[model samples]
Target: MSANTLRAECATPGTQHVETGHRVATRSAVLRYPSLTTTVPKEFVHRASVAEVMLTDWERREDHRFVVTAQWPRSHSFFTTANGCHDPLIAAETLRQAGSLLAHAEYGVPLGHHFLMWDLSLTVLPEHLSVGDAPAALDIDVVCSDIKTRRGSLAGFRYATVMRRAGHVVATGGASFTCVAPHVYQRLRAHRLSGAGAQLPLTAPTAPQDVGRVSPTDVVLSPIGQRDRWQLRVDTRHPVLFEHPVDHIPGMMLLEAARQATVATLGEGVTPLSVIAEFSRYAELDAPCVIEARRLPRTEHEEAVEVTGHQDGEQVVRSTVTAAASAG
Candidate 1:
């Protein structure tokens, strides 16, 4: 196997400007950057997006695998809450980019198009990674063994990312995404973007602790006076969450709701070891949405929790969260 090294600089808003020479490379083509922007085609992300581009460089090893480096600015809210450890979304975003890079760099897939996310999953072991005090930066390496695509539909691939501090593996998990044409994605987001958004009917915002988060500003779903359920609060005025405007509830927020619901299911705090989430349709902001988590039968390998979100009576999101069977 052959490997290439590409380096560049990162200049995100809160990044610690290190004088140490670090080359951030995205592709075979190398160029200097006046500012840090995403190498992934803008079209790949929704017009209004929340993906924080953490990995600034790539070193491709093969079509199925690559070793990438990401430096998380200590001040980045998207990657961390009260805790310093890198958030699950960080890994999610990393896996997302790996698929994008593989499709374009390895498979010759063009950019400036769109892809649909059919499913995504990850497993976290607390002992495997340090979440109490996350490092200022990370060394992320990803590998993909199975990738599939067709001429007129979505392209899909399964990938895993390993985070290392110094030279030891701290955390690892695998996930998958399916790509679709711009038209298909637009069609899926159409109803939510129709400018018919309605103010969500819900109670006052609850504390982040109510949802397993340590920060109050991080809470988006509040209790709805229902057992084991929460009302989705689309606070467009939030800074970190609504950094900009959005048409509907971000997929990540919904997933966070699931994470919180998992906490409710277990009563005790939980570090999700495995999660499988699927989206059936756009969860509209104007409509009322409820998220529910159901306890699952215990397995020899892990304890399971299942989550679902609904708009009115229609199901929008479904997820299964599992934690390691042994105590951490």
Candidate 2:
């Protein structure tokens, strides 16, 4: 195989050869060599809009190891901080896109397959995230491990990433997700496949400053009567969060809710620097999901908050967010 070649084999019985140009997949196998280009296909990242795709290009270094490149604008409409630094969640989004791209473009997972993220974690240095005069070019070194395959198709994998800017380490993160074929996904989401009429009434969000956010539209938690608790607000009309329609709440929205809940619990002047999250099940949009945050035993330099989301008496997401005082 060549440096850019990706080999895929079809093991299913009675399957005939399917050819696309020079590539063919029969009961045997085939090889595909991606052209070297900076433009990443939006479908590889599972994004509806090309503008939302973070990855610019990727190259396989060796088996299970790859290098992915991305570009972060000097200013983003949503992923910015009032403290003049970039939001740490940007790392999370980049990590998510990088993994999805690798799975589809490298591992031979079809484009129509669905991904179920089991867990995600990211840690960033505050000073490293400060917006520079120009857009930041990032190179991410990714190592995929514990790969699972079935019927010669990728089932799932866990990957770790280290992001660098100008040779300086900016962020480190990892995530694990499983892939489901189209038919299996349809069976899994039988009745709730469509997003039509699945959204509930919009509730009023808390003050933007209270949650360390500048825009009310970006806040994902609505204040309730109880302290350290809020209702997860679902805004299907939001341009970025709900870029395209889906039947359930987006994982990024849940992550934002967790960040807001932590900020609210820890008071102002603190910015989240690390986040570790686990998703047990999908958060349906039609039901009310309650978000709660409680302070954990403080460390010397950081404060931790455990944020949980409960829908219909079942926990859907649990995240531990660690924050530190913003750099002056």
Candidate 3:
């Protein structure tokens, strides 16, 4: 069947009559089908492919709730020299997309602006999930709990997300996002609310801790206390810092910035082998920050370093980066 026809059939209601053991009975029920069969729009599909190496299916559970399922295909692009997970941001972005889908489904609106994931804290569970050519599926549940205005006219939502694989918790995290009136969002919101503006109250969190100033050229080249390890820092306002919108600063980009800083700290002529990161909090824009690293104890063949990002006297991100010497 054509995609459109299949979608219509799935959405249409059908009546069914049943006979119980004692007597005949009639009831109305709405048939529900797997969201995978409900193809995602072409634009969204393309966006998903480019944003992350994954595909997602979304189903509306209620006016304010949605279930999003995502599958990440194993490929060379996601592999590392160490042969484990290549990028932690892959999972982080997948979880972000799941939350975005939930918001769209709940509000019956299309995403208007790019999402800025202001904060994320994740722990790699003891159970190692698969990292291979086969596809791995994750079920995500999201909820918006607080709404607030900040940094002038920006409206933000505090979101909580839960991720699962094979009925086991893989990760759970929260984030804050500001909504903008983009063409798609405007059209969807108009259709859903019939042109009436639905205003939700704002709920802003307390101010974050303050770290020291970070300079754009603050490169550590190598950790002061360890060999083959490095540390560095960057101001958020640096030109190279805001180049990629997809990374969403403070979220993925900040992690990359931290990684790059660590590489710089390793000084000249060193290349990274792998990087594993765990986000802890938001790193505000235009704020001064500090990054520190030290060599971790490793085997003869592998080298590792412990890296930390701090802003306002609080630790925002922690990472472990490993690399091999050019000749070794």
- Estimate the TM-score for candidate 1: 0.72
Model 1 per-residue lDDT tens digits across residues 164-232: 656766557666666666677678777666776566654566666656776666676777778878877
TM-score-based ranking:
2, 1, 3
Q: Quantify how close model 1 is to the true structure by its C-alpha RMSD in Å.
A: 8.1
Better of 1 and 2 by TM-score: 2
Each prediction's Cα RMSD? Answer: 8.1, 9.8, 14.1
Q: Could you tell me the TM-score of candidate 2?
A: 0.87
Tens digit of per-residue lDDT, candidate 2, span 1-328: 2223332333545557888899875643333333443447788888888878788878889999999989887777778855677778888999999999999888999989999999999999878888888878899999999999989999999999999999999999999999999999999998787644456899999999999888899889998999999999899888889988777898999999999998888887677889999999999988999999999988677889999999999999999999884443
Write candidate 3's Cα lDDT for 163-230 as tens digits: 77789876666666655556544564444335232322222211111111133232212233444333
Task: Evaluate all candidate structures by whole-model CA lDDT and list the values in order.
Answer: 0.64, 0.87, 0.49
Candidate 2's C-alpha runs over 4 A off are 1-38, 194-198, 325-328
Summed backbone clashes in each candidate are 9, 0, 16
TM match of model 3 to true structure = 0.49
Superposed Cα deviation of residue 201, candidate 2 (Å): 0.7
Better of 1 and 3 by TM-score: 1
Best candidate per TM-score, number? 2
Each model's TM-score, in the order given? 0.72, 0.87, 0.49
What shift in Å separates residue 276 of candidate 3 from its native position after superposition? 13
